[model samples]
Target chain A: MEKAIEVKDLRKSFKSAAVLKGVDFEVKRGEIFALLGSNGAGKTTIVKILATLLKPDGGTATVNGFDVAAHSENVRQSISLTGQFAAVDEILTGRENLIMIAKLRHLKNPRQVAADLLKRFGLVDAADRRASTYSGGMRRRLDIAMSLIGKPQLIFLDEPTTGLDPEARIEVWNVVKELANSGTTVFLTTQYLEEAEQLADQIAILHEGRIIVSGTLEELKKLFPPAKVEYVEKQPSLEELFLALIGKKEEK
Target chain B: METTKKHFLSDIGVMLGRSMRHITRSMDTIITVCITPIAMMLLFVYVLGGAIQAGTDNYVNYLLPGILLMAIASGIAYTAFRLFMDMQSGIFERFHSMPIARSAVLWGHVLTSLVSNAISVIVIILVALIMGFRSSAGIVSWLAVAGILALVTLALTWIAVIPGLTAKSIDGASAFSYPLIFLPFISSAFVPTDSMPTVVRAFAENQPVTSIVDAIRALLSNQPVGSEIWIALAWCLGILIVAYLLAMLVYKRKAL
Candidate 1:
């Protein structure tokens, strides 16, 4: 099968400042491909181009077998985008937000689709409440649920867990994992190394508008210095510590 | 192409429904928009009515047109603010990336402004009636006045969209309306343009608001609406077309 996404010498600029300078990358179908980058690294620029929200100055990109520039409508039909901030309508109830997206996608039964997603995402209890009252985790889950309404072949998640709590981050991670398991390709951008390490089947580091390194976790690890044979007490990560604290407090 | 056009109307309907819900839930916006204009009407009619020589028996009758215009001017500020919020919250990007008719997103806001402003105009007119304002105009004249108000709303709402798409700050987004809200004061809305100094009179007579207010005033009192109606329509349609073209250009360039 053809690649889910292919970019060749993609270039873009704002006024005189060059962003995404001749970048090249490819993503296989049904895999989690993480574009790792820090702030102002043109990660969003790349995603916007692929999603057909922005026009590129040079090069070509094909998303889901259609040129992003020439056949944007086809590419749009094949993909959904979850932006950096949770894009829920604060005034609408959680169910309404999903139904709104479902209707926009021309779904047959918008209310039923919203109900099913609400139940699946554990948001059924909060479905009637305005999204403004939702916690950060819940809102992000709702945003992801909205994106999944049309069941696009591909999804672009930009900084999906930037400000999320550890539990919420894990929740988003599980959702992404579930998406890939269902054979939907995911293209995600993030500044977190651990997020890329935790969820990505393929990781590509974007630096200075180009991909500096691209490989699997194992292949990329080989480029580092060999690990020394030493024994030390293993420390739990902050995520583990926080979860443990919360578990103890709840039990008490 | 056929399918895209088919989806456009339905897409606008969906977007419009979403925005109308925002308006209905936030009743404060409509109330806030109506409050200032109504207060101004009361102030002008009760306190300043005897002094100003507007050459009309009931000051409320003369002031209603201007008050309605002011209410619409303020009402559309919410349109800019809502669009700005969407841009900041990333919802704008999500919508843009979807496979829907893109311009429908904006038409939704524009049409919502028309409806919300219409509601404000109707409320203000009801308040004017309670204050003893009356009109000899029949149904056709009423519709003509409604048509003018709708045109004004469309023209101003398109102007609002420009700032909505391009403003860097929330304050900047809504601030454009302050001048618009105050524009009626300098026109023939409050008093006859002949009462002003020569330069001010020249401006009052020439500005779009003057023609609009005069046309509305004539239509309300069942006076012969001569050239004022044409001039008013010209101003509104001119502004509408220019503002719409400019707004679409900004939207295309901003790529939001």
Candidate 2:
């Protein structure tokens, strides 16, 4: 498999404080590679560097075979980024936002591209409504749709479902899954462990600005021991029962 | 849409549309921009008109140019403020990730400021015309006035983008424009610099505002502009080139 992204000793520091300290990682093409970290763990910083939004102070990164610094535009052409929060222009309608990005990307039929993305994202109904009026999920869907204007080979979604309700979060998850299933490489960063488990084919846990662990789910499960160890106890807490019933629907 | 060579121009159009939408939604900035110039025009014409010896037949026309400059200076501050908010909001970061040109972002806003300031200028001119201020200058001179104003507006806009991008707080982003708004008062706007103290006159006559105000006054009155038009264009172009280079440098280094 081809490497979709590669980072070597990437270091970024704001002032005297370091955010990314000699980090290294890689993502294979056509895989959903999830980055799991807490807030301020430099997950977003890494994403920014890979997306060419922020330049790393030290070390180098490449995306889709283009160096982020030397060949920035080529890297830019191969990737799309959806930030932690929806960056949709509230003043523009959902359809306009999509078409605007399409035009920016120099697509031949911008309106048609926008309409197709809107329909695929299940946003056809709210197409003409101003994005400010849309729900958080709708705006986020529009943001992702905008990212797809150029049909990027790689997509970076930084905490894409952070503020959504449960149902809306699932909607985003489904969209992400579909993108990966269609051969697009997705680099996702989220604080939710369940989200990583649901979406990631290759999981990497970042701690204190470094990837402490990276492996497939089953490999990680073997290293950490069973998250739920089976026991023959006669009683269990109500919280455990509730967790089993409602917390993870597909973990079983 | 054609050749991506003109991508910057189209980006300006899109940015103008978005910025106008924001301004229309929040009418406070436009209202504030209009209020300052109109209030100053009224105060200068009604209260200070008789006392200040401008030597011009119509003080409103003479004062109109100054007030228009003040309006433009004050108006672009909101552009800085809005851009600052968009920067803080991560919208800029989102745009940067795409294949769009970086310069287009600022141009979008600079053009927006130009358009909105033009409207404010028109409103102020209309109000002044209604109050016995008339310009007999031909269409060519009017076009010259527009060209100068556009250059001035673009220069200040590039200057404003620096503070907007570099400022940490909302107040900090907009605070730099306060001095620009007050710059007109010390120039030939309110009174001729030679009538003031030697030091004050030195500062006033040498600044960009004096040349700009004098050029506009000459254009409106159909008088010989002498060297003031060239001086004004030089000042505007100088500021524009320098500010654009600096703003781009500041932008290139920004963490966004």
Candidate 3:
């Protein structure tokens, strides 16, 4: 498979403090590749470099066959980034936000693209509401929808579900999985182990500005001693109960 | 290259649209812009105008030009405020990742500042007119007033961009404008520089605001503009070029 992203000995520093120290990784095309890291592990720095938002102090990175530093404009044209923050313009309505991105991308029909994305993201009902009034889940959905404006072949999602409740997190996960299913490569950073296990086709754990280990889920699982599996009657998880109660309350 | 130019223009338009939307949504900025300068005008014309002799019989007309400058100075603080807000949010990073022309982002804020400041000036002018501010100058002189105000706004807005990018707090971002607001007082805006002490008079007579104020005052009264217009233009252009370069440099460093 073609590689979507390639990083070699990536190094970045903020003043005297080095953030990424000789980190290296690769993400394949059309796969969900998760980078697991703790806070200050330099996941954001890596994402910023690959997205051409920041230049690496040392080493090299390429995205979609374009050198991030040398052909940054070309790389930028092929990728979209959903930053840690929502990054949506709060004063604008959801529809206006999407239209703004589409227009910025120089699409021929910004209005139609915005309308279609709003419907696809199940945000049509809230499309005219200002983004500042949106629920956290709605804002995240709008953010992802905005990123897909130009139908970029590669996407960088930096901590896509950091503060979300389970239902909202799953909603974002579904959107991410759909992107990969449609053959768009996804590079995401996360702090949740289950998130990596559930969605990623491959995972790399980043520790202290370096990828400690990387492999497919099953391949990494083999490194640990196996325990006997047992089946029991499953109960509704607390998350599920919480979501159900919230849904009912809103309905009433 | 042709398509790139086209893309740059379109991207600026789109970003300008976003900034304009924000301006319309926030009513507080509009109120603040109108109230501050008009209040200063009313206070000086009623209370202080009687005591301070500024060579003109109608203090409102003499004070109107400088108050317009003050209004613009105050209005541009909002530009820094908005730019600081955009910087704090990750939108700057998102824009950095986009393929659009890099300068378009700054231009959007700059253009929005020009538009909003122009509106604030117009509102202040209308209030001045209501309070007996009049001028005998023809179409060309009126155009000159607009032109000079536009240049002043352009110059100061670029200066505002510097703090907006580098400031750690909102107060820090906006504090730069206080000096700008105070500049008119030290110059010939309220009282003539001749009435001041020697050192104070020297500074007031040589500063940028005095020339701008004198030029506008001359144009309003149909007096010969003479060299004050040239000096005012020189000051505005010099500050504009320097501030533009410094702001862009700071912006590039912060983006990293």
**DockQ (CA atoms), all models:** 0.74, 0.49, 0.75
What stretches of model 2 exceed 4 Å from their correct place?
A225-252, B1-8, B24-28
**Best of the two (1, 2) by DockQ:** 1
What's the distance in Å from true for residue A71, model 2? Answer: 0.9
The TM-score obtained for chain B by all candidates, in the order given, is 0.98, 0.95, 0.97
Q: After superposition, how far is residue B43 of candidate 2 from its true place, in Å?
A: 1.7
Identify the candidate with maximal DockQ: 3
Off by over 4 Å in 1: A248-252
Residue A206 CA displacement from its true place in model 1, Å: 0.9
- The positional error of residue A178 in candidate 3, measured at the CA in angstroms, is 0.9
Error of 2 at B220 (Å): 1.5
TM-score (C-alpha, index-matched) for candidate 1: 0.98
User: lDDT scores for all predictions?
Assistant: 0.94, 0.87, 0.91
Lowest lDDT block of 10, candidate 3 chain B: B1-10
lDDT of 2 by residue, A1-252 (tens): 399999999999988999888898899999999999998999999998899888889898989888898877788778998998788888778998887787777778988998899899999999999898999888888888888778899999999999897778888999999999999999999999999999999999999878898999899989965678678767867746765677587676
Q: Model 3, residue B99: what's the lDDT?
A: 82
